[model samples]
Target: MSKTLHHGLLLLRVLSEQPQGLTVSELADAISVHRTVAHRLVRTLEAHELCRRDHQRRIVLGTGLVSLAEPVQQDLRTLARPILDELAESTRATAHLLVRDGAARMRALMVVEPRGALVHVSFRPGQTHSIEQGSGGVAVLAHGPHREGERPEVSEARAKGYAVTTGEVIPAVTGISAAVPARDRTATASIGISVFEYTDLGQLGTTVAAAARSLGRLLD
Candidate 1:
C-alpha cells in the first residue's frame, strides 16, 4: 500500500513486542528507519488509534489493536484450556505454555501450581524472559524447524520430537521437555511440562507426548 501505511504497520509490530511502550528513538533503532520517518509513522498509528503516545512520549499499542487482538486471543485460550488441564493431571507437575521474548523464552501461562511451600515455583502475569537453551524455548523454536537464525541445534530438537533443557535455563530442576505444535505461523507458543527428575520419566513422558499431540491437532 502507501508508504505511510507500511511504515505504520512496521512500527506497530515493534511496539507490539514490548508491553511497556517504546520511545521514538527505540523504535527508530529497532526498525532501522530514520528518526523523522519513525516519528511520522507513530503519529499515523496514533491517528488510527493503533498506537498511543504517553506523557513521556513513549508509544504503546492502542484501542484499535485491542479491537483486532481480542477475538484471536479469546479463541486461543478457549482451545488451549482443556489441553493444559489434561497435561497437568498427566504430568503430576506444572505444565505451561511459554512464548518467546527477544532471544529468550519465559513462562506465559500455566495450568498447574507447585505444591510445596519451600520448593515452590510460580509464574505471574507480567513475567518476561529470553529464548535461550531451554526445553520450553527450544521446543517452540525447534518444533517447526524454524531456523531463521542463530540456532543450528534447533534442527536437532525438531528431529527429536521434543526438547530437553537440563537445568540450562533453570537451576536444580532436572529438565523440561516441550513441543511446539505450531511455530510456523504462531511462533511464540508451545506446550511443555517441568519435571523434578525424581518423578517417573516413562509415565510423564507418555502423558506429555499425548498432551503435545493434542495441542498439535489444534495448531494444525
Candidate 2:
C-alpha cells in the first residue's frame, strides 16, 4: 500500500478503538508515526470530514464514515429480508432488525422494518435509540458490554435468551427480541417485533429467540 494510505488506515484503526478519540501525539505514538506526519494525515481526514476534532480537541470519527457505512445497513436489511418476513408473518407484528453503528458507540440503529399486519406497528429505519432502553437494545446488550453493576433486565435477557419490554421505546407497544450473535466481541445485531398487545408472552419470546438463532447462524 502507499505510505499515505497506510498512515490514514492506521489512524482510522486507532481512532476506532478509542471511544473518547485521541490526540495527534497519542495517535502518533499508537501508530509509531511522527507527530508532524500524524498531524498532516489528520488534517487530510478532517478536510474530507472523515475525522474531526471534538469539543475536547481530540481527533474523532466524523459523519463521512457514517455515509460510507450506510450501505452496510442496506446490505444487512437485504440479507435479513426473508428472515424478517418470516418473523413478521409468524407473529403478525411489525418485525425489525437493529444493528450498532460502530464498535465503540452504544447506539443501536434500526436497519430493517418488515410490516406484518395491516394494523401492525410502524417504525422507521435509521432511527437510533439508547442501547439500554428497548427490547431491541437490550437484546444487543445481553451479548455486548455492561457497566460494573449491570441492569437486572440485561441479566434476565441473558438468562432467558431473549428480551421483552413494554412502553419502553414506544409507549403502548410491546416488544420482543433476541440477539443475533456476532463472531467478534462487538454488540452484534438484534431482531425484534412490536405489537399493540400480546396475549401469550412465552410463545412470542420463543419464536423471536428462534428467529434470532437462525439469523445468527446465517450471519456466522
Candidate 3:
C-alpha cells in the first residue's frame, strides 16, 4: 500500500480504540508518525468526513463512517436475522452475531433477544472486546489457523466445536459461542448466546454450533 494510505488507515484505527478522541500529537505517537504528517492525514480524513475534530479539539471518527458501515451491517443483519431469531428463541437466551474487527478484537454485529423468554440477557449491538476475552471472540479464534501463544481456550474450543466463558464480558453471566465457518469468505464471525445462569453446556454448545453451521452455509 502507499505510505500515506497506510498511515491514514493506521490513524483511523488508533482513533477507533479511543472513542473520546485523541489529540494530533497523541495520534502521531499512536501511529508512530510525525505530528505534521498525522495532522495532514487527519485533514484529509476530515475532507472525506471520515474523521472530525471534536469541540475539545481532539480528532474523532466522523459520522460518514456510519453511512458507509450501515449498509454492510444491515446486509449482515438481514442475512442473519432468521438464524439469530431461531437461535435466541430455541435457546431462550439472548443471541448475538459477532464479527472480527481486525486481528485482535471482535464486534457484536447483531443481537436478538428470545421472544418468549420472560427473563433474558440484554446488550446492545456494536459492543467490542478483545479476541481473547469472551466466548464469541475465542470461538472465532478457534476457527482460524492456530497461532503461537494463543489462549488455551481457543484450542479447547477448536476441539469441542464451541467456546464457553463465564463473567468475561458480563459479570455473573455465561456465554457460549461457535464460529461461523469462513469457507470462501474473508468474513470471520461467531454466533453465541448469553444466559444469566449456567445450564446444560453440552446441549447449549451443540445448539450454538449447529446454528453457526447453518449460518455458515447461508454465507457460503
Best by lDDT: 3
Tens-digit lDDT string for candidate 2 (34-145): 9999999999999999999999999988889888877976776667888888888888888888876555333434433444355778877777766778898788878765
Question: Total clashing residue pairs per candidate?
Answer: 5, 0, 0
Highest TM-score, which number? 2
**TM, every model:** 0.67, 0.79, 0.74
On a 0 to 100 scale, what is the lDDT of residue 32 in model 2? 92
**Per-residue lDDT of 21 in model 1:** 85
- Candidate closer to the true structure by lDDT (higher is better), 1 or 3: 3
Write model 1 residue lDDT over 1-220, tens digit each, in one string.
7877677777777777786889999999988889998988888778889889877878888888757766765676677788877776645566776655433345565445544423434455335456666677776777554556746556666776666666665575644555655635445666667666645655565566577777667867
Q: State, as a TM-score between 0 and 1, how close model 3 is to the true structure.
A: 0.74
Identify the runs in model 3 with alpha carbons over 4 angstroms from their true place: 1-42, 51-63, 183-187
Q: CA RMSD for every model?
A: 4.8, 3.4, 4.0
- Over 4 Å off in model 2, which ranges? 1-38, 54-58, 103-118, 145-147
In candidate 1, the residue pairs with backbone N, CA or C atoms under 3 Å apart (3 or more residues apart, or in different chains) clash, namely 103-131, 104-130, 104-131, 105-130, 105-131
lDDT of 3 by residue, 1-220 (tens): 6999999988888877787889999999999999999999999999999999999999988988879888877887898999999999888999999987655788999999998788999899889998889999999888878889988898999899999998999998999999998676433899999999855889999999999999888877
Per-residue error (Å), model 3, residue 102 = 4.7
Q: Looking at model 3, which ten-residue stretch has the lowest summed lDDT?
A: 180-189
Instruction: Rank the candidate models, highest lDDT first.
Output: 3, 2, 1
Q: What is the lDDT of residue 29 in candidate 3?
A: 95
